[model samples]
Target: MAKTILVVDDSASLRQVVGIALRGAGYDVIEACDGQDALNKLTGQKVHLMISDVNMPNMDGISFVKAVKQRPAYRFTPIVMLTTESQESKKAEGQAAGAKAWVVKPFRPEQMLGVVQKLVLP
Candidate 1:
């Protein structure tokens, strides 16, 4: 079965772009507008991986990562922070919160796919 991925970002266009790439690569996608929405989606099913943006309304990606780690069901689900922020401080903060990989914004589709492949085990 195709692995499912939860994509959390406030930009609808960005979600659609990433969703298209993921779907083309044979992964199922669940999209959420922000950290809160992503947390809400987590309860439904097994998400093999997560791609999130750092700056979002209600809750940001770092906080989201912390929250996800606290949940027993989704504790080990690998997360990739796909955001515009490239500061070491922000990356360290995300790393501390339990994110596995970090991908900066304006990324190529194949680059994103490669990161997904490495993290999402079949």
Candidate 2:
């Protein structure tokens, strides 16, 4: 079975782009507009990975990562922050929140897929 990825971002276009790329790469995708929606979509499902944006209307990526860690079922699930913020401080914050990797926005599909491949377990 293909791995399932949850992508959280406020931009619909961004989500679409990432979804297409993930699906094309033979992964299943679940999209959410922000952290709250992403949490709702969790539903104790088997999400192999997560890609989230930093700045959003409801809960942000860092906070979302923290919340995800609190859940026993998803505590070890890998997360990658995909955002426009490239600051070292912000990256540190995401790392502290348990994100395993970071990918900046306007990313090439192949680049994102490479990281996903590294993080997603077989």
Candidate 3:
């Protein structure tokens, strides 16, 4: 079965690009516009991974990651922060919030896919 990945980003173009890459790699992709929207989509489904943007309306990626970790069902799901922020502090914050990896914006699809492949739950 194909692994499912939830992608949360406020930018429509980013979501589309990530979705295309994941779909091309034979993984199922679910998109959300923001942290709140992503939470709404969780629905107890089995998701192997999540990719999220840090800056957004409603809730930010860090808060979302913390929230996801609090949920028993998704606590073990690997989360990757895909964002423009490159500062070590931001990356540390994301890690503290339970994100397993960080991928900076303007990323090559192949590069992000490689990280996804490595951290995705089996």
Q: Flag regions of model 3 displaced more than 4 Å.
A: none
lDDT of 2 by residue, 17-118 (tens): 999999999999999999999999999989999999999998999999999999998999999999999999999999999999999988999999999999
Off by over 4 Å in 2: none
Query: What ordering of candidates by lDDT runs from best to worst?
Result: 3, 2, 1
Greater-lDDT candidate between 2 and 3:
3
lDDT of 3 by residue, 27-120 (tens): 9999999999999999999999999999999999999999999999999999999999999999999999899999998999999999999999
Q: What is the TM-score of each predicted model, taking all chains together?
A: 0.98, 0.98, 0.99
lDDT for model 1: 0.95
| Candidate 1 RMSD computed on C-alpha atoms after optimal superposition onto the true structure | 0.7
lDDT of each: 0.95, 0.96, 0.97
- lDDT value for model 3: 0.97
Model 1, residue 98: distance off in Å is 0.5
Looking at model 2, residue 8 earns an lDDT score of 98
